[model samples]
Target: MTTNPQETTPNDWDTRSPDVQADQVAAYDAMRSKCPVAHDDYMGYSLLKNADIKYALEHPEIFSNKVSTRHIAVPNGMDAPEHTAFRAVNDKYFTPDRMQVFEPQIRQVVKSLVSKLPRNEVFDAMDGFAQLYAVRIQNVFMGWPASLEQPLIEWVEKNRRATLAGDREQMGKIALEFDGYIRALLDERRGADAAADITAELIQDVIDLPQDLGGPRTMTDEELISLIRNWTVGELSTVSACAGIILAFLAEHPQEQDRLRTSLAVGKTAEIAAAVEEVMRLQDPLVTNRRVTTQPVEIGGRSIPAGAKVTINWASANRDEDAFEDATTYNPHRSQENNLVYGQGLHVCPGAPLARLELRVLMEELLATTDLIEFGGANPTQNAVYPAAGYSKVLTRIS
Candidate 1:
């Protein structure tokens, strides 16, 4: 199809181009049709189809997770036995029992945020509700003070900007700023109490590292800070994006909204959770995850050399037409066993249970409290640029 330049030369695809940034999902959706794998300067090789992404996830060895040496990303940046040890430490926080115990707090946070929604007024849900929901729940989880709410929110926004601009210096400063916040918390918790909150609880948890590096030792402050940053910064931005996406979808599709509300009334939580997963599959909250090729590899009929960077395009993979029947339509009942919403394999999000619980509780609370959810009709929504997925500004209404 010489109709479009993108179809002719996939490598020329500029992720930072104006059209692509304006609506990433639409751009990626188009990319999947013309090219399954795309390459550009900023994002490296991008996997646009579900099969290719799953292939990479299934074989982490060939596509290594250790994409950078400049900074430590705790488990997200670790690979193999090292990743295993750190991952075990990460997994304990989101266990079934831990999530069960933490459910009420999630409900409380959601209910509190829901109660504050302005009725019959135009408000930006991204800033007013979604970000608040993510920040407050994160605070609840870590026993962080309410004072940190605004700062964390601000930090997330700044982090997004820095990341999109590819300003490594600014990102490094942002990282240190976050580490400072965690360091202060650690100081406050020192000898004050054990397992006071998840952050404090981490003090007692030990990573079963290799014997050469002092096996079974507690994580250092730096390591603890890195892990906590993964838990907080990663959660806040993406969850807020997810909340915005879900709320906007509800606003636009009254039938599905009513269906979910009724399902909530009947205690059809499994249905609601399935709906959330399906919606996320429609519009993924996280964009790309990076990996570096351990050796030269052939993927999707393209030859990629060793140590080359790879960006897994969750936005595209989740929306691939080949992956789901009528992939663009919203249908919760269809099989979603292959959904890459939270990811797959070893690095499959350790915090998924908590994320699911939070979203489920949020939906239950928002729907139960409001008779309807719809657009504010005063302002058009803004789609977030790359490095962030979902709405940047959503005009929402609740009646």
Candidate 2:
């Protein structure tokens, strides 16, 4: 139940269960406050304190992202100079200008989905509202055929299974299937050679790596397919989870909902943004991010040797008592500039702005239309392993 700073290691992480991971993070917070930095060969010498986390994030040299736990783009994998290059490929798509262009489309997507809900009927908001909306938008962003939506849902499920199983053959088979699908899309875009969609823009993007690390790095066809697959894996499940969690919290706290409604009356994005942040804090979509040490390093005066794997307890770090007041309680207005939900440093999420926009807009639309959303059936249970936190079903009545 308690994490001893001197006891845990990088190798101790459970890659399969979010509940178990959450427990580990909770335990780590106990030690983080006292030790700040600690050694655990199982955990790699992790710097758990807020100060240490900031340091580790900012100083990518000491703690690298080159060998990522997720086998995709180097965005979350590669550290420093190289990280910047991988990030740039999709950076423009998530920029303010692009977000402005995508806003109407995103709003329309949410609106259409919400309109389809039966009047006064109970439905699972997580499945009906969150996952459906997020998946549709993701498809829009990826330029995938609409027909593939069902396939995508299946793909995400199968991909998660492969990842947890560590089945490379199964993973590769799925990846090839996706690649063929994307390649056709790529070919279509190339054939038209006209106005570019976000996916097309990414395909044509030439990543310019820093000279110090290497020359310009272009995303190969396979890499592009992998990146899109990774994006599908990384973005959809968490966003959907967050969407449901936000609504669930709002449904439970009518006063907060009233406050949010009042703010929306005046068209204040900050109010909704604040509420979303709190949801993010409480929901903690991603339980952990893992890394394998390439070189031995000393942390908290203890040395962690090379080739060790470490888990970044994001959920724990965000809730560290040292970092926030009443870390366990949900406070909508707690607007700190740094929240680990999107991550930190050079490897911060490239799609964060778009994701934020998606969340903010989804909330706004929901609040505007629905007066009340109350759970109708059994309490929703989340997936224990893959996708970390999300409802298997969340039946609710729209008022």
Candidate 2 lDDT by residue in tens digits, 1-399: 744433545443333445444444455556666565544444445556555566667766766676544565546666656666777775766779878988898899889987888778766676556766778999887666688777767776677678767798998898777778778877777765644676777767888976775677667876777677667777877777777776677666788777888899998879999888877875577766666555676654556556655556676677777678887687877756557888876777788898889989988988889787666766543433443563445566778
Cα RMSD to the true fold for all candidates: 4.3, 4.7
> Which stretches of model 2 miss by more than 4 angstroms?
1-49, 68-72, 192-195, 210-214, 300-302, 381-383
- Index of the highest-TM-score prediction: 1
lDDT of model 2 at residue 57?
Answer: 71
Top lDDT model: 1
Off by over 4 Å in 1: 1-10, 193-195
Residues 1-399 of candidate 1: C-alpha lDDT, one tens digit per residue: 223212233464899999999999999999878877788877778898899999999999998988878778899988988899999989988899989999998898888888988998778898778998999999998898999999998999899999988998999999889888889988888864544787787888989999876788999887888889989988998999989998898888888888988898898888888888888899999998999888888898777777677899988888787888999999999999778988999889888999899988887787899888889875558999988899889988788
Residue 196 CA error for candidate 2 (Å)?
Answer: 2.5
List TM-scores for all candidates, in order: 0.95, 0.85
If candidate 1 were superposed on the true structure by all CA atoms, what would the RMSD be?
4.3
CA error at residue 52 for candidate 2, angstroms:
3.5
Query: What TM-score does candidate 2 get on C-alpha atoms?
Result: 0.85
